[model samples]
Target: MVDSVKVAGIQMEPKILEKELNLERCLDFIQTAARQGAKLLVFPECALTGYCFSSLDEGLSVAEAIPGPSTEAIASVCRELEVYVVMGLLEKSGNKCYNALAFVGPEGLIGSYRKIHLPYLGIDRFATPGNRPFRVYDTPVGRVGLNICFDVRFPESSRVMALQGAEVIALPTNWPKGAESAPRFIVHTRAYENRVNYIAVDRVGVERGFRFIGQSKIVDYNGRTLAEADVSREEIIYADLDLKATREKRVVIIPGEFELPLFEGRRPEFYGLICERGESVEC
Candidate 1:
């Protein structure tokens, strides 16, 4: 019901294998952002537990159930601050481990999204692929969707959420040194293509010798950079996002002449190949 929401992206480093320390850091950041009138706060991928684990056992060590102690702690803080947060952490389900983002609010645990696309680097190399379908959670802030680090690379993920009426997509990512192009191009491209406000929060500092690029960014529905962080510092970037404006997919520059009905002009019938998989389905 809110027309606009102030979003904050916390760009901080998580210590490897230090769950308690990371949780403390997250609480500190949450308090700081909430006090600043930020309605929605997003943290980097594995912000509760650092990425680049050597093995699945190691990841599972810090990994917890979605609504377990860590999320409960966050929910308590959210209740006091009256805010919403999307934070990344490793998830342990039975014998499998997954890289996930938990969406918590003042009420309680809203939902969680597991990383569907598993890149061959860091903990993702060993984590189980996400099993659930993409979902958009309607909250006090807006219709918010969740995605992890590698999931941003796939256009289908964002498109799916956009089709589900998601106004904002919170992407908690851990971008290393070689993945500079993601923040530079992909974040804004996804925002423009989907007409949804996109916030990508990335971590800083080195974990296991892999230096993460901390260029956390917040882009509007029009793909404009509202706020951005530096490459190697711990910082918080803020943006006042217009949720109502994101829902207006039809853009009229000259009223009758230069009108762009982005969603209305979609040709899903011809885009069947996007849903097809396997090597048999040729490009």
Candidate 2:
């Protein structure tokens, strides 16, 4: 297993309802990133199909099944380049449509993550909530986990993945203008609290008049920002992550004088309210 790996995040604008064009753009980015020595390349949410869909039917029109045409094409590229690619798309399974991210490696389609926490925005407003549990995909690059746009707001999402031994968590997001705080603070907070490397890839450009904020970034396990992109542009950010360092959750500052045993110090028994579903009551 490689302890050190270079990762890249592609922040680009996707034309709404243009699957083929978006796929071509994704392919171009994939080739460029791979050539630049990135083993893991992550794209923004709904890179294949644009967000801000007017209806569920519209989302369904472009949604495809996992291991479908897109993943197969991406897998072929990965096979040729020996790289891993994670891109967001609308997924159709049975009678439900989900906002999802597909993890494709050189081997083939590794797995996919449905957006569990769906905010009332874009395709998620009409899409079905994710039914599966949060999963961490163990790859040659590292133990990688995935989260969609709004999932980052819920700390439990990242906590679960971190507990499952996720060395790197990729967050494919489509943040609009009002969501400036997310890129400024949330990414670092999640990485610091979980003691895992985090990458939040967001889109750029206006979609149906809703402009996306393109502050895609890569943060280290200790909450340090390795690379960050501007707020409005198409760009690729790279960061060399130390997978082995992320495994050492115990941060010994001055030989235990000020140490933080992240997971080991968790007191889960007292955090029961987090899992309890109940009527909203002012505490």
Candidate 3:
């Protein structure tokens, strides 16, 4: 049987548009998590760029291709420290830009996921949507998935990952102050509905005139938050995800199927009734 995994969330501030500073900060955070005996570490969204970079040109300037500078830096720690790391980076893919996350492990770089849903605000101007819905990377610990800020809002996305045998859902986010509840609700609900672990790492402090509330947390499959950090403080949160207990409960409670209704399940006669009424499918 697989063993329980120790995970850490880096809830901290970042230097705006400076990849060097961000890389250094990540290295320190990785060391800190390793010292705490964490097997995996999750960092906040745009942890490298600190979100809200002033110009698209400037943001893209900082954006690096996956397997480029960012992953290589973390690759050293993964090899030396033997910890799995999920970190956010601005990705420049040809002419378009994506808010992306990279998964690094002791074996080297595992996989990268582009953020599917881009939140509105100034970010809408700089980021583009990813064509894919979910990305699950195979790690020594287990299969881990990535869900960016707005992607967690869509239940379809989370269910797809859970259906794919994801043992953990790692989220990277930047939310303005007073918007903390959304991340909390979304992450907790994902854990509960999917019967899998969920982690959310958020950025603290303001960047480029935007306020970010940090309340990073880790949730168990039963929707219990094992650990949560303060809103404003730059902190590192740690916890052990009891994979054994979660799988046992899955067999007992029999978690709902993580899938959507099919077209065959549709009531075409009723649908024709609604269309005949000159309206949409539902209220």
User: Taking the tens digit of each residue's C-alpha lDDT, what string does model 2 give over 75-130?
Assistant: 99999999999999999987789999999999999999899998899998899999
Candidate 3: tens digits of C-alpha lDDT, residues 85-181 = 9999888888778888988998778988888877675454678888765767767776788988777887768777877777888988887876777
Q: Give the lDDT of residue 116 in candidate 3.
A: 82
Deviation in angstroms for 208 in model 1?
Answer: 0.6
- The best candidate in terms of TM-score: 1
Predictions in order: lDDT: 0.94, 0.93, 0.81
Off by over 4 Å in 1: 279-283
lDDT of 3 at 12: 86
Task: Give the range where candidate 1 is weakest over 10 consecutive residues by summed lDDT.
Answer: 274-283
Listed per candidate, the RMSD to the true structure in angstroms reads 1.0, 1.1, 4.9
Candidate 1 on 1-283: residue-level lDDT in tens? 8789999999999999999999999999999999899999999999988999999999999999988999999999999999999999999999899899899998999999999999999899899999999999999899999999889999999999999999999999999999999999999999999999999999999999999999999999999999999999999999999999888889889989999999999989999887788657755
Question: Which ranges of candidate 2 are over 4 A from the true structure?
Answer: 279-283
* Candidate achieving higher lDDT, 2 or 3: 2
Query: Cα miss at 9, model 1 (Å)?
Result: 0.2
Off by over 4 Å in 3: 248-283
Superposition error at 122 for model 3 (Å) = 3.8
Q: Residue 217, candidate 3: how far off, in angstroms?
A: 0.4
